[model samples]
Target: MLVRVLGSAAGGGFPQWNCNCPNCDGLRRGSIRATARTQSSIAVSANGVDWLLVNASPDVLTQLRAAPALQPARAIRDSGIAAVLLMDAQIDHVTGLLMLRERSTPLPLMATPEVLSDLSDGLPLTRVLSHYCGVAPLPLALDAPQAVPGLPGVTVLALPLPSKPPPYSPFRERPRRGDNIGLLLANPQTGRRLFYAPGLGEVSDAVLATMRGCDVVLVDGTFWTEDEMIRMGLSRKAAAEMGHLPQSGAGGMIAQLDRLPSGVRKVLIHINNTNPILRDDAPERAELTAHGIEVAFDGMEIAF
Candidate 1:
């Protein structure tokens, strides 16, 4: 099994275009400590030939351009993706589906029922795609492992996690409940298993034990501290409130990861722009390295 990091940044991308924040300014100044990243997305290949896109990022076209394999062989309307497995329904995660509108048939999407329901509503994906019938919703049941149609050796398992809608939305009235999820991927042909959760709220012991024997783990690296969004004025809530763990500070990622058994090989994904760790010179990066954790970058490939 081969996993590729297509886009490693969280929403708005690293150094968001309209953002005037210090990080954004630093990136523009060509500071060595700053790095630019596209929106979050990943691709998993069963035999390194056929691949499944983890999420359809807003930068899908560019990401696809970066990887020659995603381009349509005959025309852009063909379904180049074997299938798409959505980790969540966040705008940053699903906006890229628009670029696939040129595809003639509905793209097969594997996701939880709640997530499918949210997409059916006025979420960004449905709203933009409402006028067109290009994309169709295919929901996956929790706990049931589904064999990807084209990927013979790989099977994807959906693990339900607690999640809700944005607090500011009028849709908050009913609020999407239990939509968030993590993935447990396995390639029996290669005897590889990976536990992936790029937007996790809490790390449960059950999940830890469940993934104990996996070869590689890609978990959330959204913020360095709970107050990251507040400090940046991007949001009024903390990272924890948004259902993620800060990679820094007390009781944060370092501490939580400390308890994991040796040899787990943890890598952080869905990194935010404001996190100083994005800078190779930052102390946070060094700390994570010393602790045996890696920060995922675009184009980084993991094989197991």
Candidate 2:
């Protein structure tokens, strides 16, 4: 399996345009030991030729430009991207579909039924894309492993997660089982597994079982503490309220990750710009490193 960490920042990205928080200010001035990151997204390839994008962030155009492997080949308009799998209906995750409208052929998009319905009704990306390069919605079933279309050696399992719907959704009662999900990619050829969950509200028993014995696990690192956004004066909602589990505290992702097998390579992704771990010299970064956890950066590649 070949995995590429295309972007690692949360929705607004690091050094978000409107804010001048300490991390953003330091990044803008080059005063901090942190790298500029786009919104969270990743690309996976089983054969190194045809690739499947995990989530298409708003920065997909720039992200694609940075990854040479995803560029066109011999044909002038040929793209290496075979399909795109959406985890949720968030603007940051699906807006990039507009950028892909210029493709010569229609694109295959996979998402849970709830996410697809939300896009069909409220956001209408599915309706709009039908005019350009059409979007073929492939509905994903929770806990059911399905072959990723056009990618022969790869199989993806969508594990239901506890997360709220995007704020823009027309039906905003509360999140159900399939509103958000995590992906488990398995390569039967190499006996390697990779568990990726960039949006997590809680670590349920199903999530733990899915992550066990995986070669690599990339989980959410959105906030360092439950009250991070509150303390930073960024937002009034707690991390859990925003559908993210913090990395600190007793009932946090860090403690959950600690329980995983030691052989599993653990990584953190989808980090918020306000999180102190973005700073290279921050004590939080040191603590994560001490626990054998890697903080993902844009353009980082791992092959196993």
Candidate 3:
């Protein structure tokens, strides 16, 4: 199993434009010890040749350029992105599908029925793409594991996560079970498992079990504290309200991560720009390291 962290920052990305916040400003001026990051997304490959993108972030074009493996040079007009697995219907996660409209064949898109409905109705991305390379929607079952369409030997199980739908969704207030999900990927050849939930709000029993059984767990690290955005005056909603589990406070992400077995490789992704862990010299970074969790960076890769 080959896993790649293509981008690690949350929605607007680290050092997001239009906002001169400390982290963003300091990073731009080279006064901070942090690295620039794009919006959150990941790519996984069973054979290393045929890659499966976990989410098509708004920064997917830049991510694709950074990872040469995703642009295999078999022909002048070819791509190594075998299929796309959407975790939700959020703008950041699904907008990049437009950048992939140049593909020769209809792209295989797997997502929960709810997520597909949003793109088809609310966002109309699936409808617009009909004129382009088009999309072939596939099923992502919550009851059992389904084989990834383009990647052989790789299977993924959809676990219902505690999260809300995007604002554009008509059912935003009436959140459904399949509105949000995390993917548990298994490599049959290596018998390695990975739990990836970049938008987790709570660690349910099924999520806990998935983490325990997997060798690698890549999770949401959207906020450092529960009221991060509120404290920064960026938004009125707290982190929890936005479907993210903050890293600090009682029963927070760190506390949950601490309970995992030492053998499991734990890593954090989808970090918000306001999170202090992005600063290399920050105490928060040290704290996570001490607890055996890695802060994912763009291009970070793990092979098992």
List model 2 lDDT by residue over 151-186, tens digit each: 888789998887778888876776677889999888
lDDT of 3 by residue, 71-95 (tens): 8899989888899999999998999
RMSD to the native, candidate 1? 2.3
Candidate 1 ranges beyond 4 A from true positions:
72-79, 124-133, 166-177
Local error of candidate 2 at 38, Å?
A: 0.6
lDDT of 1 by residue, 124-219 (tens): 565566566455556777777888777778788888776665443435556554477788888786677888888887777776675676777898
Q: Using Cα atoms with residue i matched to residue i, what is each candidate's TM-score against the true structure?
A: 0.91, 0.98, 0.98
- What stretches of model 2 exceed 4 Å from their correct place? none
User: What's the lDDT for candidate 3?
Assistant: 0.91
lDDT (Cα) of model 1: 0.79
Cα-based RMSD of the predictions, in order?
Answer: 2.3, 1.0, 0.9
Select the stronger candidate by TM-score from 1 and 2. Answer: 2
